[model samples]
Target chain A: MLRELFNSENSVLYHVGKFVMWQKEIYKKPENWSMYYKEIVRQMYDIGIGSLTIVMIISLFIGAVTAVQFSYQLSGGLIPEYYIGYVVRDMTIIELAATITCLVLAGKVGSNMAAEIGGMRQKEHIDAMEVMGVNTSAYIIMPKIIAAIIVIPLLVSLSAIVGIMGGYLASIATGSVTEADYIKGLRSFFVPYNVLMMYVKAFVFAFILTSVSCYQGYFVKGGSIELGEASTRAVVYSDILILVADFIIALVLTS
Target chain B: MIRVEKIHKSFGEQEVLKGIDFTFETGKTNLIIGKSGAGKTVLLKLLVGLMKPTKGKVWYDKLDFVNLSKEELQSLRMDVGMLFQGNALFDSLTVEENIRFPLDMFSKKMSIDEKQERVNTCLAKVELEGVNHKYPSEISGGMQKRVGIARAIVLNPKYLFCDEPNSGLDPKTAITIDELISNITKEFNITTVINTHDMNSVMEIGENICLLHQGKLAWQGSKEAVLDSSNETLTDFIFASPFLKKLRNAAAG
Candidate 1:
């Protein structure tokens, strides 16, 4: 039992050390700034415009549900009806928009990254680049991380606005609250720091998802079955890391 | 010239290459021929610095490749080109884009027109002139291999490594590829190393051949000596098939 425990611990440490070393290689000075810029532009288009619709859909529903549920809980209570909008606003901004939307993207974008890079590895494309003196890690992965960090936060901000709109639409449509009351709730007691917190969370989660997915894909070996497993692992690991980062960011930034 | 000294490689407990020492002469087609699991690919990878040897030193013309710093290695790699067995063409890029990738990444001083001219020259050298805009999937496998060769030589590298350059092609195309590599080797006088198990390649363009058997250098000789030599291991590998053995016997008679 002790030996098994030691072996497992060693495995974990080995992977952690490898992961850190991989990050160091990825951030090395690029060979050509223009080439990296072009890749970053392509990645921005892929991560940003490609992911807009899904983010809109999820954020809207999450806000609507929050509003409706808050309304139900406050029914016949002395608490004001407009509090539903406040609850939706704070929940969407402080947590849901950045965290949940990124969790979904961890499935969509993260898995795509893993499969693409892992396929490159399997096909020897990475080897070809390595031979040509291209820094495969920096060339392939850095742009992806940069693009994600730039775009995912923009996506989260958009989600926050759409979510608020969703909550407003839900409350006014259901006749549970007046428009003036909902607007008042949105305006009342707004903390700008919460928006800062949202952006911080978005950035951290974006880094986690992109870096973890790229790491998984960059080092992948074997054939198709292994590629598929890497894709799945990218999503699973990115989601787990995003949640963990979410908690830590909440503790650090919010405090 | 590229040389490996006392090269050894291992994966955990299993040793893949056990003390390989050889020199690949400049302006010659050097072949590393081996059966499956004979560490041909591992040695190729080590020479290219894609994988480090468990124990050995690789010298690229007096520079210790095994001990170069990361920046130094990258600089050294700029002068090296390689063709993978699968061709390794970027699937999404067009033929022109694929061929021009090395230039775009490394040749910062060259203008777009100069780069285009260079790409054209490489394509023409490979006999692939009119297929620039087509994707890899649209091209035939032979054309793709030619494109891969075109891409590898675009920068006029000092060293060229080809891993099974003729694996998936017809015999005629395989010979064409061998001749192309040979012509390029002589034309530019680049040190060329090919890792292949194809017996035909050994007889056709192998100026210097090193046969690996089960992790050791089994035989070293020229193509002229291959047919006449009585090395048991070489004979066994070359005549592994009964039909080839019969053909060899008939040819000998």
Candidate 2:
């Protein structure tokens, strides 16, 4: 039994168990509120403001391409061309905005969180903090998780707006629909429930990405090679989990 | 005082530290000296409660360290400070901020001015006063180590731990760092435990030395006892180099 326990120490079950246990440490009350506040503010800037440009670029194209594709599909069919605006608006708000934007952010913010914390682990900064009686888990990770949870939903909201605007611009430029008709299409089927769905997906994905990435980085061992592997795994795992969560949320919510 | 009894550590199938008993003296530089893989680092980690031993009782005065509650461990941790091998100063924070970090986090009663004054005092104690605003990356390795030392002592910890404190420094700088740590231990009357293989440190500030060989305590004594001791493991480790062996032989002659 002892030998078996020792052999299983490096298994996936072991890491998963360890990860679950670490959450307790992460959620403990802050030793000092102001210190936590400062860290949270710094992380908010890094995640929210620092990511604005990429999110904008990706969201714009997603919106444009979506508009043009629907416009082409609706042309000469039983459906009216103005349906493109309705389709783009709903698609951007419901699925594309949160899902695609989070996938992009899972790569951007997730890898960054992993690298930053993994670098600290490698350099023994975490150890230094542990020695200083600082709860390394709460101090290092809580801020990042809180910042991501708060700001990622906001970013998703921004992406939805920007994507809708991009659809409007593309349709007008290509003469796919008249401006008045497109505006009418946008107004025709506005479901308030879909906005709620978008936020649910956003908040859930934000937690998964940030928490998984920080976990990958926090427990990293060895040197640069291990740190790099941890970072890559953070992105990959976050993406997969985000997709999985998206499917589950869609199933439960849409039903 | 810090004491360990019957300490045993194992990683997977490999046992690194066998049952051993030792006490670290307060107000002195107590060195855990051994060749690589002899479990000096493991022992240090066990003492600091970073990694628990497979079997052991570690004591800080009368309190049982290994079996403390979370609150007790945290409270114990506040009295402990460690200087890591890489110096581990936050790259983004200036030296002042680095030293002031623990004070800011733990000493909530201290005002900003009081914290700044403490930082300044620590820097001055380490004889590094002028570069408070410089980030850690902008400083030299030695200066970073000094900043690390200042930060470690900023909270006036009852115990100080140094892991390979002289690993990256030039010989002169290594001696300077060693002397600084020794002086701090004496001045603060802190229980200072140092894990190193540096002969210079083992000779200069080694008031008490514990040598581990093949996961057991091979010897324990003062710096003065090191040269006269006839233990084969001690001699082999201390005089592994030909030049050092010849010097020992000449000294014996």
Candidate 3:
């Protein structure tokens, strides 16, 4: 037991150190500006457009559920009826939109990145590129990170808007609160800093997910079974780290 | 010339390559022939700088590979080309793009027309012209290997490393590939190192052969010498199959 524990601890330390070192390599001066630019554009389209529908569906449902539950809790209370909209707005902006959207993306985008890179590694594509004098780490990974940092925040912002619209539709459709009351609540107690907080969370979560997933894929070994495991680990670790980072960001930024 | 001096490689507690020393001559087809698990792939990886040696040094014409910085290694790699066993063509890119990749990445000053012309020349050299727009999946295995060769030589490298270039191909196609590699090596006068277990390849283009047995250089000779050499390990390996042994006996008789 002691030996296994010690080995596991050492493994974690080794991976963490490798991850940091790999980041340093990934940011090295690119071989060609045009090639990197083209790759970044390709990744942007893939992450942004490829993920739009799923993000829309999940965010809409999450907002509707929050609205309905808040209406139920605030029923016949001393709190104003419009307070449901206010709560939903703040929740979506400060926490739900950025955190939930990113957690979901961590699963979707992270696993895809891992699988694609792992497949390349398995096929010796990475080796082929390495022999061609291309820095495989930077060529394969830097674009994904840059694209995610640029696009995920945009996706989160879109999710926020769609989610608020979902809350509005749900509340007014169910007749739990009048349309006028919800709109008034949304306009009240609106802090601009909450939007900043959401963007901050989005940027940090995007970085964590892309970098971790790329790292998992870049060093993958063995056959199909190992590749699958790496993909799963990418999603699982990215999700866990996003949640942990969310808590820390909330503590540090909100306080 | 590529020279490995007392190179050793280990993974954890297991040592894969044990003090291997050999020089691959320029303008010749150098073959590393070995059985599976004899560290052929490990040695190839070390030569390409994909994996570092646990001990000793690799020299590319007196530039010590083991001690080079990252930038220096990258610069060295610019003159290197490799063809993998699996071809390793990007599935998303068409044949033209695949061949054009090196030129695109490293030669920014070259115009698009010049790049296209160079790509065309490489494709023509491989007898793979008119298939440039097709993706890798759209092509047959032999054609894919040709495309791989086109990509490897697109930049006109000084050193070429091919790992199992004839694997999964028909005997005729394998011979054709061997002849193609031999022609390219002679035409360019570049050092070509091939890691293969195929006796056919050894007989065809093994100008300087190094046979490995359990991570040691078991035999080193020319293709003609491989047939007549009295090295036990080489004889045992070459005649491991009954069919080859019978052929050897018939030839001897």
Candidate 2: residue pairs that collide: none
TM agreement with the true structure for every prediction: 0.97, 0.97, 0.97
TM-score of the first chain in candidate 1 relative to the native first chain: 0.96
Q: Which candidate should be chosen as best, given lDDT against the real structure? A: 1
Which of 1 and 3 is the better model by lDDT?
A: 1
Candidate 3 chain B: 10-residue stretch with minimal lDDT:
B70-79
Model 3: how large is the Cα RMSD against the reference?
A: 1.7
Each candidate: RMSD to true structure? Answer: 1.8, 1.7, 1.7
> What DockQ do the predictions score, one after another?
0.89, 0.85, 0.90
Candidate 3 to truth, TM: 0.97
Arrange candidates, best DockQ first: 3, 1, 2
| Model 3 stretches astray by more than 4 angstroms | A1-10
Tens-digit lDDT string for candidate 3 (A35-140): 9999999999999999999999988988888899999999989999999889889889999999998889988999999999999999999989988989888999
lDDT of 1: 0.94
lDDT of 2 by residue, A1-255 (tens): 655554485676676777789999999999999999999999999999999999998999898899999998887899987788899999999999999989999899999999999999999899888878889999999999999999999999999999988999999999999898888888878999999999999999999999999999998988899999999999999999999999999999989
Off by over 4 Å in 1: A1-10
Candidate 3 lDDT over B1-253, as tens digits, reads 9999998999899888999899999999999999999999999999998899999899999899999997788788888989999999999999999999999999999999999999999998888878989999999899999999999998899999999999999999999999999999999999999999998999999999999999888889899998789999999988899999998889889
Deviation from truth (RMSD, Å), model 2: 1.7
Q: Among all windows of ten consecutive residues in candidate 3 chain A, which has the lowest summed lDDT?
A: A1-10
